[model samples]
Target: MTSNFRHVALIGKYQASSAGSTGDSSRQALEDIAHFLERQGCEVALEAETASNAGLTHDYPSLNVDEIGARCDLGLVVGGDGTMLGIGRRLARFGTPLIGINQGRLGFITDIPFDTYQATLSPMLKGAYEEDLRPLMHATVVRDERIVFEALAMNDVVVNRGATSGMVELRVEVGGRLVANQRADGLIIASPTGSTAYSLSAGGPMLHPSIPGWVLVPIAPHTLSNRPIVLSDATEVAVEVVSGRDVSANFDMQSLASLLHGDRILVKRSEHCVRFLHPQGWNYFATLRKKLRWNEGGS
Candidate 1:
C-alpha cells in the first residue's frame, strides 16, 4: 500500500556510534529502514547529520533540518528519546509528524521496538495510527534588560549551579507575581511531557501529558520548606539568579547559557508543538507501565 506520507525523513542516533562497530550498525540500520520505507512506496531522505556521522553513502538524498522540515511529510526517528527530543524541537516549527523506533534503553517517547518496527511501522505509514500533539516551551535569558539567549524546550528548562559551587539563590515569579526566594542546587521548570523526566527524579509530581500545566522542582534546597509546585501553563514563569557562581541555564538539556547575577530566565508556552504518530491502540499508561516497570508483578 502507498504510504499516507509520500516523503519521509530517516534520522538515526549517530551519537551512539562512537565505536567502529556501532557506527557500522547505525549505518546498516538507516539503510535497512530506508529500504523498508521505499518498499512502502514512500520516498526517503537521510537527515544530513545522520548521514554524515554514520557515513551513509546511499543514493538517497541527504537533507538538512530545514530541508527536511520543508519537504518531508513524515520523520521516522530511529533512536532513543534524546534523539527524538532533538529533532522534535527543530521540526516543531514546520509541523511535520514524527514516529519513533526505539534503539535506546528507555523508549518513553520512542515507543516502537526496533526489532519489530517493520511489523508496526508498515500500517502506521498507511494512516493506521494515533496522533499526539506535545507542546513546547520557549525560554530566554535576559541580562541587562536585553534578551541574551533563547531556545525552545520540549522537556524542561534547567538552571543549575556549577559542580564546584555551593547552593544557588533564585527569585521565582509566576505570571508577573512574586512566588518565592529559593536557595538550592538548581531549579527545574518542566512541561507536562517532562514530568517523568528530571522533574520526577527531583521529587515533582508526574503530570499527565494532557495537562495544561508546568512543574517547578527544586534540586536539594537549602531549606526543607522549599518544595515542588505545579502551575497553570498560561502563566509566565521567571527565575532570576539572585546569588550564584558559574550558574547556567539549559533548555531541554540541549542548549545552554551561563547566568550571572540578576539574569532572569523567562519561560512560557511555545506556539509550536510536536506531532507524534503512534501505532493504533497505543496507550500512555501502557507505555508508563512498560517503561517504568509499573506492571512488573502483575498478571
Candidate 2:
C-alpha cells in the first residue's frame, strides 16, 4: 500500500474481438469494474467513449480525456497496451497515474488480467500497488528552424519512408555532433520504455525501463556497419531528411507527419513522465518471461 486513490477513471478499447459478435464478456467486465470501485467508496468516472462502448446507463458519469486528466486521482485502462499508450500520452501532460487491466493480446503494459480483477483491483484500490514513472519523448519536426509538427510518444519515434519500396537517407546528429549518415528504410529513436517495441524488432538491444537513455536503431540499413546506438537522456537528437525523399515521422506508430527535403525531426526527453500503478507482486521480469516466453528456450 502506497497512496490512497480516491477518484478513479476508466478507459478502454472500443472494439472487442471475442465470441463471434456479442462482446458480452468485455462489456460486463467494464460495468463490474465501475461498480466495484463505487462499492469500495471511491468516486469513479468513465471516459466518454468507454462509457459509450460499455453501454453505460445515464446514471453513470462520463468525462472526456481532458476532464479525467484534470480531476481523477488515478485512471484504470481496461484494454491492451495500445489503449494505454493512447491514454498515457494524453494524461502525461497532467501527471495522472494510470493502472491497466488486460483485455487484449500481449498485455505487456496492461499488467492486470480480467480473471484477476476481483482479487487485484480491490486491494490495489485500497492502496496496495507499485508506482512506476516512465519517461516519454517530445518530438518535433522543424522545417527551416520553425516547428511544423509536434507530438508526444510513449513508445518510439520513427522516421521512415512512406508508401514506397525504396530506401531513404537520414543524417543523424546528437547534441550537434554527427552520429551517422544512414541509408536505410528508416530510423527509430526509442525511449527505454520502448526498447522492446519496434526498436527490438529492428534488432536493437533490449533496454531496461530504468535506464536513462534512448536507443537509435537503424532499420534495414544498406550497410551492416550501421547499427543501433544508445544515447543519454540528456542528449538532443536531430534527424535531417538528406535523401530528398518524402518520409513520415510517427509517434507511437500513431500520429504521423510528412517530411520533405531539409526537414529535421528533433527528439528529446519530455519534461513530463507517465506514472503507472502496478498491483502488489507485479514483477516486470516475470511479465517478460510470460509474454515473451523466455524460459521455454526455443531459439
Evaluated with TM-score, which candidate comes out highest?
Answer: 1
Model-by-model lDDT, in order? Answer: 0.92, 0.86
RMSD of each: 1.4, 2.8
Top of the candidates by lDDT = 1
Per-residue lDDT of 283 in model 1: 86
Give the Å shift of residue 245 in candidate 2. Answer: 3.2
With a 3 Å backbone cut-off (N, CA, C), the pairs that clash in candidate 2 are none
Off by over 4 Å in 2: 1-3, 15-23, 296-299
lDDT of 2: 0.86
Tens digit of lDDT per residue, candidate 1, span 1-299?
Answer: 68899999999885856359888888888889999998999999999889887877456789999999999999999989999999999999999999999875658799998899999998898889999999999999999999999999999999999999999999999999999999999999999889999999999999988899999999999998989999999999999999989999998888899999999999999999999999999888888888888855653
- When summed lDDT is taken over every stretch of 10 residues in candidate 2, the lowest stretch is 14-23
